[model samples]
Target: MEKEDLKLLQQKVTKLRAEGKYKETIEACYHLLKSGKECNDFKSILTAHINHAASYYCIGDTEEAFNSIEAYVEVCSRFGDEADLLHQYNVLFLLYEYNKDFAKAKATLENCIGLGKKLEKYNIVSNGYSNISHVLMEEGNYGAALEAGQKGLEASKLHKPASPILELRVKLNIAKAYLELNHFHASKALINEMIHDPILESFIREKSQCYHLQGSWYRKQKIFKEAFDSLTVAKELVESYRDLYLLKSIQEERCQLCEQMEDVQLGYRVQKEYISLLNEINKQELALTALKLEIKHSMSDFKRKANTDFLTGIFNRSYLETTSKEWLEQASVKDENIVCILFDIDNFKIINDQYGHLFGDEVIKQVSNACSKTMKENELFARYGGDEFVVLVRGASLESGKKRAEEMRGIIGNVKIEMGGNSVSITSSMGVTDNLDGKVRSFQELFHHADLGLYEAKKSGKNNVCVKLADKE
Candidate 1:
């Protein structure tokens, strides 16, 4: 087939799949595969195999789905990119999970995490950890699930511009784990934190989960009225969203709540509703299964793109500013040290004038890479503006912050990018400040102090570091 024809066929298959026409998608993929094979087009064949698997899975043809996925994986191993491999692992994990093959699902998630870390795909890493937590939770290993949930949250922070939904998911998992462990205070604290987040109102599924968990928390405390109200809201949300799986879970919870309240009539009514919902879900499972898989895949991509900076692959100014305030509040409550560092490329305009914008872009990438290499797990680095960057270090003292800033300066200074026939060197000046007096500094105050330190560094020399302490009063 010609390139344009092949492109058109691919688009047709995609559209059919999105429209829930699984049978038609399968037929189109097979035809495309056959045509491409006649012309020895391995790339097109690989694409067909992947789509074929997804279509088969949606239609409940597990045997054929497995065969298609096997072929897809084999081709991916030979010619696919990291993203391709990540997708394959996710599909495999979901397949195993649906089949109740917990061991295989866990193993696949672990492998996915390894590859995600190797490629610096922090979003994939976070998903892998979250999936692992889910599996552990299902297996009734609350302790392990709690640990995995925490790890997932940590990995999520490594992603640029950190996704709010992803963070909420991890926190919900942790709260569930805590509930199982009878840590009511901890679980309640986490749930209450998200209950009023305006963002939750838009995410129907997440909001349902939040209310469900809140219901569970109330049940544990024997607050029957509150539990009933929360669970009712959760059920309504799930029904409105048409989330059959979550709806089933919510109905079961309602039945349990009714039984605990000694409302036999209500319990019986809920039980019947639950059974009816389960039967309907099973009837439509094949069709909904495929749609769910596609939604999961698209959501991951959407969240990553929404939270990522296209140029530097690091956090942007908005993310830094918003997240830093939350971190500051938490640190203040705990009386822990929180440090901020502001820095910018020294003589950046001269470099741009001498080397052109393209070369200047290369310099920015190289410098960002160098700084990223020096970052600790708890530190956040972001591109504040054209040439300036900011770093937030939690649990760091004034002296330690200064030391880290100096180390970053040294690493950035030694970075050399080869341009044409010349080796161009880059250096940065840094200003460091810390809030250690148990005072909660506003974002503006923190930035102002850090900027003052940067000014002192620039005054002393172009490539140096300076530290400014918070006001003692």
Candidate 2:
């Protein structure tokens, strides 16, 4: 290959890059590097490789992009090219940031900044600081992001940047970092300059973004009217840009606020009605209260009988299922936690077979007693099936359930029952599951998970408690 041919190949690569055809650009670069022995410009070849790497990075192929950057770094180091070295560091920094390796990304940016300062390349220093701030913001290290953004602004002030538009871009980046860090006043001041400066408008979309940031700041301050007004304007601008998902979210939030307002009004009306009704009640109030108490007592008795296992005096499967559904609904709406425990006597059927029916009944009763004593007050303890019982610890965390289940395991394992003048020890295996606040679990699904956990406990070793992973749900 001649020099003219290599130059033509580089031109074609530049054209492909401009067209955003990254694969074609990389392929052309690879062909030139492989086929052109006559091409002697090592720096130009390294430039092509770095450009190819940047193209891949733009297309979200960061892994391949980083591999290309590594190659470029080696070539640039061999040639002692400081500019390409800085570019390689910046590229690697971005790759780490994209991978959510924030600490490593920050370190790389700082290295780049250090190199830029030593080389008197203020633009590179500003770029490094700006990117570090962006990474910190993304990682929710907002305070650090604001500090880094301010440093970037200071770096920009030290540079005679080639592009005047670069200053506005850097200032906008600083304001964005401030917004993320909840430095609303500082962000607002920077944004106000953008709002009044006509030059800023041509270079950036600052107007709507500034309004959105101000609205969010107002929201944090609990000035709902101000927040709503600003957000409404931002919503209009975002809608014009056809950002439908964000528009829908804003509309949903507005609708929810409206619903909350209506609920408050309705609650007031309900309270008024209750007061009027109570005042209208005359001599019958005492009798009504007495009748209500009697009715409540009767219903409680009826519910107990309906839900209780007759033989063991624990909750039956019917009650556990019904109560579990109710608890599941409450947890779903209120973000409450619930734990379900499924326990079965180990080799229960064998005991029934080896011993007489009376002894079997005694074993079941002993197991139920063990469950009752082990559970907390008002916790649902039910006989789910023959020799199988369930415990529902409402508002129980995973840790709490483990402790409670372990206590039950110990109690059941240590229990000594005298049947037919013989003392026998019984062991039970339990599966415990507690739903987290954000999870939506049905009663049946919860029960199924607990059962699967029980199977695991049995397989691991009987007379123990096992917890299911969140993924099992």
Candidate 1: stretches off by over 4 Å: 268-272, 275-279, 282-473
Model 1 agreement with the true structure over 1-473: per-residue lDDT tens digits? 79778878878887898887876787688777766766677667777887877777766667767898899888888888877888788878878988889999999999999999999888888888888989999999999999999999998888887688878888889889999999998999999998888889889888988999999899889998799899999999888968787788788778878888999988888888999998889878755676656744654565455445667888887678778889888877888888999999999999999989988888888889889988889999998888899999988888888999989998998998898888878889999898764485677788888999999999998799988876765
Each prediction's TM-score against the native? 0.57, 0.47
Q: What is the C-alpha local distance difference test score of each model?
A: 0.85, 0.73
Any idea what lDDT model 2 has? 0.73
Model 2 C-alpha lDDT per residue in residues 255-328, reported as the tens digit of each score? 44334445566445434543544454433446545644553465466657766899998878877877788888
In candidate 2, how many Å is residue 63 off? Answer: 2.7
Global local distance difference test of model 1: 0.85
Task: Give the top-scoring candidate (lDDT).
Answer: 1
Give the distance in Å from residue 311's predicted Cα in candidate 2 to where it truly belongs.
90
